[model samples]
Target: MKKIMVVLMVCLMVLNGCTKDNTQDYTKVSNQTYLLGTLVKVTVYGKDVSKEVFNGAFDIIKNIEATVSKNEDNSEVSQINKGQEISLSESTYKIIEKGLYYSQVSKGKFDITIAPLVNLWGIGTKNAKVPSHEEIQEAIKKINYKHITLDQKTNKIQIHQPIELDLGAIAKGYVADEVSAYLMEHNMGHAIINLGGNILTVGEKPDGSSWKIGIQNPFDARGTKLGVVTIGQKSVVTSGIYERYLEEGDKQYHHILDPFTGYPVENELASVSIISNLSIDGDGLSTVVFSMGLEEGFDFIEGLDEVDAIFVTKDKEVYLTSGADEIFMLTHEDFKKKQMKK
Candidate 1:
């Protein structure tokens, strides 16, 4: 399975400064709003567009976030976690269903019932601290997706045990997908959406060019670009350990917690970028592949269909899968390219 694909021995350099103030096109309309605990930006290309167009698209994101956000006390996910049997909206049910599907496909590598572990770690909050080994062991016991039960008829979600579900990995992807669907329905010629790094392009640019998404340099705190993934009308989502971390003393712990270990996934890869037609798939699989480590991560990607990954090891070596070469183009010469799978 280890075969060399298109290996381009090209010099990859970072862009000096963005020449375009917004997107490459001027007819495209864009709006930014706060949702899903992050900044959500949507751009659409066409004429005679009202503010409601963007507002309507953003409303879908807001409604879904309010439903599944684990932090909200009145959220449906929160209610379900509290042992109350409740019915979910179609949107809510579909995301949880997709979340469970990824969990099963990853064989527990990606789980929605890992909120207990998240709360225990509290990586992004002021409560972030290292918990006792016993506490981690206790949290691990509840990190099973099988503990959640969903009824298709009534659209109800029930937690069998004290399990909690966190849809952070998949929610933004789903939101992006929803926004894209809306854009397509409205016959938007070209658009780009950046929901705090989870990017989705609608159709192509007016000039019919692929969207150049910068893969963030994990080692740089200034959010520098290490490479660019050229894509057209696809979702490019990169998950990294650099985003949110807890610094206790001299050690650093990232937010991507392992479901089985109840700790940050310790691997040679610093970040993993997943590309697919659907942002949900890219979003969910990025974390799963990260948790699987470099060796097993490539194996997992090979078994999948229409999915590609870019692995940036802790040593700064960039690895691209077979199909990844179609979109991934390196921008940093300091990083060496590793041999990819067939």
Candidate 2:
């Protein structure tokens, strides 16, 4: 009887240990917060995931907004634009440096000083308007990225003119990258950071499979996606005129403005989505590629390393880079995929 009792107890303990291990191996926790005028969500999957982990990541994002956002009254960007030379925090300095780099590399195709044009059109604003020709020309004069000066020695930034700095084009992506790094540092190996439309992943999906991200249909309303990109640990950032626009009479005006024309960008490509290692790179290049149009955009992306793009044209034609075809799967049967040869 004693021998039988000992064997039964051992079996009970083994079953309990297995159950605990299974539960711990696949725990997932997530949280959503509103910041930077959009919904930001952090989903973490690991044995040690917690609400605290998500909160820590959210804090990093909010900190970025407090420093980089022009909307914030005392933000570093706002202070500099107000004609006051202000010293920057580490985060602010890095972002300013990157914005300038993008401006230089894209040859003014993407400019942070294009804020004046953004305000004039105000596509997503309550005061949205179709500005007069003269009004637009005046805004164009102030939309020069070269006017932004950064003194690396003192970490101070200066807007030489009346132009403002709007990092809306790239701030969310940088924040996502920062949060993702934090999660990985703490051993939260598998995580997802969704900042508005910008998404970044720290590792493969919980099932050890490739992660899947959806590309929104430009013609459809929000939540309507045309395709999915099956990727692993990458940032997916999409930019489109369809994101924010205003309709007046029979004409439609989008938020994406041309710094030179001070008007919405006119192009055959409806939207461009970039997938890259860094979210900031993906976000910054999305605007640059969108401004370049379809053909030139392909040439631009092909010159880069480890960056792929999905270009959706105005006529609903989906164009993919050679690398994009391997991961992108069109979920909506209505759209056709065209992968161009190198």
Candidate 3:
């Protein structure tokens, strides 16, 4: 899922840097928070056309939320949650189909069938609380991507076991891609789609320049800088433990849990960001890499030609694949020196 706190922090920083006289005409829309979460921002560069483009983009986002939201009473996902076979919109069905495929590709690391465990922990909900060992085991028993049955003929979905399907990890990127496609089809030349940190840059600025995207520092929430990446038309997605988390006594629990253990994966990684041509691919890959840890993720990225990854370990050590080094620009002198030494 998109980290709410980190995105808000980035927005606050961006807004503080901009003056009212120089603010761009950006239309922002946020879904119901603490539930099936999603936020979309569309900015178009044209006179009297900003509102029209924004409305068009907003419509697409709303349609996606309605189709995929688990909290929606009549949504296809909600029906799956209730263990009822239901027909879904072609778009929604395609997303679920892709999700299951990715789950297999990642060796069950990226799972949409994790809704039961997510709800049990209430990570992003008002009732956010931890669950007992027994409770988690029971939830895992019902959590299996193989249990989701799809009928290609009718586009119907059937849950072989009692489970809830949550696409929180992948839906935002898919929505962003959809909105970007809509804008391009409608003659939008230059735009930026910031779905609350799941950013996708389409075309370029009207002045013909690449969009500047800053990578958030995983350790210090407000202090330190990671680096910056320039993109003309690409997606940048970062998944970190510092995002949505809960503290209890002297320990802390993050929302990104492992389906195998029904607890957060214990690893040295602080965050992993992926850049790809498609936002949905980047979104799904980021989660998969995080769960796989540094070495395995590194090996996996090295095999892919079109994808690049940036990983920050718990020791504050940074690792970037060769593909990532092309777009990543180190702003900190010390970081630059460290890279040179390596």
Which lDDT tens digits does candidate 1 get at residues 88-117?
A: 988789889999998998799889988888
Q: What is the C-alpha local distance difference test score of each model?
A: 0.78, 0.78, 0.74
- lDDT for position 204 in model 2: 83
Query: For candidate 1, what is the TM-score?
Result: 0.90
Cα lDDT tens digits, model 2, 188-265, are 888778777788888886666777777888787666788888878999888876666678899877677778777778
Residue 334 accuracy (lDDT) in model 3: 40
Q: How displaced is residue 332 in candidate 1, in Å?
A: 0.5
Q: In model 1, what is the error at residue 92, expressed in angstroms? A: 1.0
Every candidate's CA RMSD: 6.4, 12.6, 4.1
Q: Per-residue CA lDDT of candidate 3, range 1-342, in tens?
A: 334222333320111121244346532322222212544556665434655667778878888889898879988788778878888897788789878987898888778898888888876556877788999999888778988888999988877777778888888779889988998898775667777667787786555666777777776654356787777788888888876776667777777889899898789888888888888888888888999998888888878988888887776677888878887776654443123122
* Model 1, runs deviating above 4 Å: 1-26, 340-342
Candidate 2 C-alpha error for residue 255, in Å: 1.0
Candidate 1 lowest-lDDT run of ten:
1-10
Enumerate residue pairs that collide in model 2: none
